[model samples]
Target: MVEFAICLPFVITVTMAGAELANYTTTKMRISQLALLVADNASRIGSGSMNAKTISETQINDLLTGAGLQSGRLNLFQNGRVILASLQPSATENKFVVKWQRCRGMQQVTSSYYTATNTTNLNLPVTGDIDGITVKNHLVTPPSKGAVMFVEISYTYQPLVSLQFLPSINQTINDSAALTVRDNRDYTGGTSGIYNAENATRSLCAQYTAT
Candidate 1:
């Protein structure tokens, strides 16, 4: 009886910790899935005609709503500054980019499953910030050469389970995806020169914003 009493606490603690870890893993997967969805949508919008208006907050908000994600709960950042809580077009023409910052927070599990609470703070985490999406038009001066748009999206994820016991666990996970527009269209001549425009566009899309 004495041995059972001494071991009970240890067993309970281990079991509870395992459950917490599992919950964290599930949340991480969800975040990754959401990030990909956001990136794909943003890229598609940016690929529209150069005459098309920049991606608007209303449009992005509508997309989030359609995806069953609360737009108000998301923090959208562009370039390096946090834009509208949802998304709004800036002065930059023919560009639409989005970055997924810290979307999930540490998990808090209680003794009872029914009472457990999981908190997700949309703000950036201390470890680091995730990269945002970059959408740009790949056009050059020569009218004969058609233009194409490109998008690059990146994400930084941290594991909720601490590394104290599980040394094999990775502290962070980083993932990125890139897509180029299929439409071949030419852009109007502008003050911006067209030398190596496509490469420059890709470079801009590759820019990383601090979380």
Candidate 2:
């Protein structure tokens, strides 16, 4: 009986740990793919102009709706958030700033998610990290006259096992992806943008406030 008692806890622990690990891994993979989906879609929205690619407010809303739908597999709406940022280079400052942003989910957007003023472009983790060490925080030269679609997904993981007994682990997971626009883009909502949620669907712009 004592031998059984000694091994029983270990067995239970292992089983619980396995379940937790499996869920964490699944969430990671799903969030990563989610980023890819949103970024790719963002790249395609344009005015069909040879000179510049641009996205309208309606298009942005539609893309956000699709993001929410694509993320349905993860039940992201219940506990996660996706932030879509538009990165376009400014002719005046010769750098990129968060032209605009939209989101889904209930979590507050991370401060690191936005394009920083004085930052060169979205390729850099922080767009305004000019003159920083290249190895650390710094802006890569954005594609000339082009832009990037940046997607960030953050989720709070709810463990299947009780933390009171298990080893500590972070309960948050986030993944991001960025892709250059196939063509140059205009930042002014693509020459007359859409405002109502009809094209937008859901309160995407209201989901996260830029900090």
Candidate 3:
């Protein structure tokens, strides 16, 4: 029938759109999971080791490496990025500051959704405690003094099915996760006086390798 032929194109377009939407949704969830896993691993850097009281630059690198391993299926290193930030209570009460940061993967990733508190934005208030935050895995506690692993992951998504008829959707996907350090971590870089790791044995930073 003539009408059947006309309707076929619309039907095919709708099916393709649905499939693409599903794939995008799954990709977004994977990104969120990757962020949480990296943050959790970073927060638990010294866990299960009796002598390891403080986190080291090597541990930071290892955490990022673990992130890459977890995202093997996602092909994150080639197409995405992960940023790991250490947040701690500033000298001033009721405030938190990003003590140090490291990143990995090809695509440079920073917390673009929200800027990290730099010198000018040092007065960022500390919200509620770790119990308020929830994810699939139960979170660990922070240092008694207070420290957090803030993670952000960004990935450029390639569509499974391209729809020329539909309005173009931005393929960039991002997610953030925060976890409190369960162990007493050295806020200072031991001898460095700042958060910059004195012994950066490996490079985890993508472009900004300062921390």
Candidate with maximal TM-score: 2
Candidate 2 error regions (>4 Å)? 47-54, 92-94, 115-141, 163-166, 184-211
lDDT of 1: 0.32
Query: Which candidate has the highest lDDT of all?
Result: 3
What is the C-alpha lDDT profile of model 3 across 1-211, one tens digit per residue? 9999999999988998888888888889889998989888887776333433566667777777777777766778778878776666555555445555667767766555335434222123323222322334544233547677888788888678673533477688878898887666555445321232465654434263322
Ranking by TM-score: 2, 3, 1
lDDT of 2 by residue, 1-211 (tens): 9999999999988888788787777778888888889889888886657675555667776776777777665667567777776555555465555555666677765535453442333233334423211212545335655666777788877666665443576677877777777765654442222234344343444545311
- lDDT of candidate model 3 versus the reference: 0.64
What is the lDDT for 195 in model 2?
A: 35
TM-score of 3: 0.72
The TM-scores, one per candidate, come to 0.38, 0.73, 0.72
In terms of TM-score, how similar is model 2 to the real structure? 0.73
Candidate 1 lDDT, tens digit per residue, 71-170?
Answer: 2222222211111111212224433222121121122211110111221322211112212233243221111232212111222223344544345655
When sorted by lDDT, best at the front, the candidate numbers are: 3, 2, 1
TM-score for candidate 1, please give it: 0.38
**Deviation from truth (RMSD, Å), model 1:** 15.0
Residue 114, candidate 2: Cα error in Å is 3.8
Screening candidate 3 with a backbone cut-off below 3 angstroms (N, C-alpha, C), the clashing residue pairs are none
